[model samples]
Each structure stands twice: as structure tokens, then as C-alpha cells.
Target: MKNESKELATLDYPGGKRRAKLRIVSDRVATATQGDCLRCARVAVRNLIIDGSRRTLGRVREASTSPGLVILGGNEGQAVRECAISDPCGFTAVHAREGAKLNYPESSPWGWSLANGVSIACHNSIVRDNVLTDCTDTGVVVYCSPGTKIEENHVTTKRRSAIGGILLVDAEPFSRDYSGIMVKGNVLDASGQAMRVGIGIGPSVLSDDMETIINDGSVIGNHLTGDYMGYGIATAGLQGWTIRDNLDDARYMGQPSDRCLDDPVNPPPQAFIYNSATLKESVVQDGFFDSDFAYRECVGLIVEVDVRVPGWWDAQHLENAHSS
Candidate 1:
């Protein structure tokens, strides 16, 4: 059988929800056999080989459908349990459709993420139990998905342009705009920026119209560290936003600011508040533009900061990573 494709099976849940169990295997690499393993839902699949690169993982979407669950597997060691969900060399475990839910079990022992893992561009889904490190971009990016839930994940990117532990993009293709989302219970550390926004990512008519707004969401109980760029929790092109109880965004200078004033246009701004949290120096500081970005008419402005910094020097020293 061709292993580099999705294996689909139907399951019956009593009085719950109509759910399908799927396992993606690589035909070229090691393939999984069928068995009654307790780890999966029912009549589960086994032994999905971890192929060398991202192209192998894309095969899993061969038999894609609607709102089913996806689990990412890897090869050797505790990689299925220890490393980030996918290899850092490329974008792995990516399935983009409308209305899909997925989960990845990961571990980050290195204090930094080495790859990108388990990105879901679908709408109205949940992403949980993921540990991502060293990804050059976002750990998990959500684009133009309404009523989405991003919870209980750890993202650490030590590389350049490391934006968004869990990013939300409401850009060009998002015709209806992005609203009613929740980002809660995550650890984001040492990335260039955290939770960036932009949208419209497909062969559709409105992909360019995705630059919209987000509304009616919550950002709670996240541990944000080592981001001297824009914000711990940022929302662009939206209104009616809420950010509460994100206490871990700190600085070495001992003071915390809400945001490091950066580019204002393109990605619009959302509401930000510091709750029972601390702020130092400036709750929101500015002039934080990407040194490499060549865009025109780009000015820097910081807004809606919910600063959780403990002291002054703690927050100021965060800039050292860039100058070096």
C-alpha cells in the first residue's frame, strides 16, 4: 500500500460527536500497520515512518476531508515524545482546509525550538500539548479562522525572525475577518516576536483580503520571555480584544513594558491590558522596527501594553540579543 498518504477509518462514539480517526504514513519510508492500540481512538494505525523532510509529511493530507483530528508522529528516540512535533528544517505537519482540529505531543529539553511544528490554517479548531523550539517563524500560525482555540503550548525560537509562539493571521484572504478566538496557557520564549497577525493564505479569491481584524478573545496565563520586538500578545486589524493574566513576559533589566514600539501600519492594533501584573520603564516603548525590513512608509508605534515586567534593568537588557 502507498504509505505516503492518509489512512482513514470510521469510528462510532456513543452520544458524543461524529469523529474520524486518521493516521498519515509515508509510503516511501517506514509504514504503519493496523492494530487495536489503546493510544489511538479505535482500530488505530501503527508505525508511521518519519521521512527525511517536509514533503514526506505533506502526504498525510492526500485523503483530507472535514473537521477530523490529526496527530503528528516522528521517527527514532523519544522524538514522538521528546523533540518538537516536526523537524526544524521545514514546515512539517501542516494541513490547511476549513474547520479542522489537531493535536501534537512534544517536549523541549533544549530551552529552544529547533523546528516548525503542527501548523493548522483551518478554522474553529483546538491546538494543545505542543512544545516548539528554534523555528525561524511562528511555532503555530492560525490564519483567518474564527472561533479558534490555541491553548497549552510551549514555543521557543532562538533563530532570526522568530515570530509568534502561536500566531494569528487575519489578512488578505480573510473576507469575513477574524473574531471570537482564545489564546491561553502557553510558554513563548526567545523569539524575535510573539503572536503575529496577517491573513489570506490559499488559492482563493480573497487571499489578499485577509488583512482584517480580530475580536472577542482572551489571552491568559502565558509565560512570555526574551521577546524584545513587538508584544507578548499582539492583535492587528481588529477591535474588542481582551488580554488578561499573562504574567511571564519579562525583561532582564528588571522592568517590563507592554510592547516594544514597532511598525504600526499593515498589521492593525488590538486592545491590551495589564492585570495584577507589573510594568517598568515604559509599559509600551517604541521605535522597534525590523532592521532588515525594506518596506516603505513604515513607522513604529507601541500600543495596548499589558506589561508584566518586574524591574527596570530586567526589561532593558532584552535588546542585547539583537545588537549581538
Candidate 2:
């Protein structure tokens, strides 16, 4: 499919209706040389499974604005599973936004998302075993949803403006706190940021006293590598979040201290953790580093944490090389 705004396929179920169990398998979906707002596929119904081992989905044109696969909505009991989404454009490969029911309810209606001004929502969804490359924004984006899992995926990007491999944020004003978000077993190799989980500043119609949206989740066992200009992992406005067992090799692309923040008086460390003021009960531990020790040693206090230097053989390869 090419030059269209609508998705190639969309499975949507209306509110207060019987949920549909749909399966889109073994199909090749692509949008090339298209205009704006072009998406490969979308699933809004419940109990949807998209699994095609040989399936290829991409947007070869740079004009594409949306993701390759979009999950708008799903029930709590039903789960949406997407596998093998590959080779997307510079935009997000998989995007799950605030759904219509969440935004257009009769009791209380809220405005569209502050990030992209779109209304979509998803829950109980799992994105796994996918390969996404050359994404401009992010490989996977989950906005204001609960019980979402992103696991076992490989993401790479050449664009330095790219945000990260996986980005989780709260953009809507839902009364309930976003929870059960898990990121694990993924290889994120990018020129910019690697992984970011946080909440943006937005007006919330659901609560008058809520200032900052908080997410309860965990980021674990992911291999993150990126340029020195960005962070391997960044978190903000999170509660009860744990970041552990992850490997980071983020370093300057050119010079040791080039484009990095330098402190003349109090220098930073080689590997360290950052916690925002709004972050409550969050812990970062057991972090393994395979970064450029020579660069860190030269910078002297530009990094604060102690890093373990691996052998030459182990340092030569990235994590899960075959998967990426």
C-alpha cells in the first residue's frame, strides 16, 4: 500500500460491544512513497495476534508520520501480540496511543495527547521478537497504558535525532496510575538516546491536584548503547521502578569529552545513576558496563560510577550480537 492516510488493515471494536479475536499472519505490509499519516497496520480489537515469521513491514518513504504497527485499544482480559515487525522508517515502528474510549467517554472527556495530539490507547499488549531499524523517533512507544510488555526485540537507528529504542510516557490525564510496564531482553543500538521512561507535562482533566504523572514499571536485562550526547537510560516521575541487570556502552562518537556535559568543579563518573526529585522508591542496581574505559579515565570525574573492564574478547562484541 502506498500514498494513503488510512492503515492497510484495522481491526476495531466499538465500546460496549462483543470483542473480536482477529489474527493477521503471514502477510507483507509496506507503504512506500506515501504521504503523511500512513500506517502499515492497526489493531484495536481484543485478542489479536499478529505473527508472521517471514513477514516484512516498512515505510520506505521519509514522509511517513505514523508507526508500522499501531495498537489503539484492547481489553484487560484480552492481549494483543505483535511479532516480527521489521525495517520501519525513521518514525516509530510500533506506537500505542490513548484509545477513543479513554478520551471520548460520556462522563468525562479529555483532550488529545500532548505529545502527538492523537487519541489512542492500549492495554494488555505484548510486543516481542521484532527487528526494527532506521527508526527516526523511537522503535517502540507506549503512551499512558497499563500492563504492556516489550521484550526480546532488536532495534537500531542511524538518525542522531532518534529518541530511543523504547520510550514509555504518560501523556493523558487518566485518574489511575500507569503500571505494569516491562522492558526486557532487547538490544538497543542507536546514535541518540537508548531508553527513556518518563512523564511529560500535560494538563490533566481527571485530577485537579495531580501535578506530575507517575509510572510504575521496570527496565531490566536490556543491552543499551548509544552516542555520548545521549543517555543509555533516563527515567523521570516514576514510582516503585527498578532498573537493573542492564549493560551500557554509551560513549562519545568522536572525542572523549566532545558534546558531553562537563563539570569544571565537580566532575561526573564513568557510569552513574540519575533519579529525579519526583521519582519515589526507585532503584538502579547491578548495572554492567562495557563502555570505553580509556575515554572515561581520560575525562577524570566526568563519570562518577565504577565500571568493570571486561576482557578483550568479551569487549569486542555487543550483547546478543546474533539477534541484532
RMSD to truth, every model: 14.2, 13.5
- Candidate maximizing TM-score: 2
Residue 303, model 1, lDDT: 25
After TM-score superposition, what is the CA distance of residue 103 in candidate 1 from its true location, in Å?
A: 6.3
* Full-model lDDT, candidate 1: 0.35
Off by over 4 Å in 2: 1-97, 100-120, 159-161, 173-176, 191-211, 226-229, 253-273, 286-324
lDDT of 1 by residue, 270-315 (tens): 2121211112122222322221111111213232334343531111
> Which segments of candidate 1 are over 4 A away from where they belong?
1-51, 54-84, 88-92, 99-116, 158-161, 172-177, 191-211, 227-230, 252-324
Clashes of each: 44, 15
Worst 10 residues of 1 by lDDT: 315-324
RMSD of 2: 13.5
Per-model CA lDDT versus the true structure: 0.35, 0.37
**Candidate 2 lDDT score relative to the true structure:** 0.37
Tens digit of lDDT per residue, candidate 2, span 1-324? Answer: 222222322355222223232222323332122211233233122222222111132222333343333233322222223222322222322334443222110000000111111122455456565555433334555565666566776765432223335565545534444577677887776543222211111112111222454657778888766543234554444567777887766553322245233432112332333334545787767542322111121221122222233422111100111111
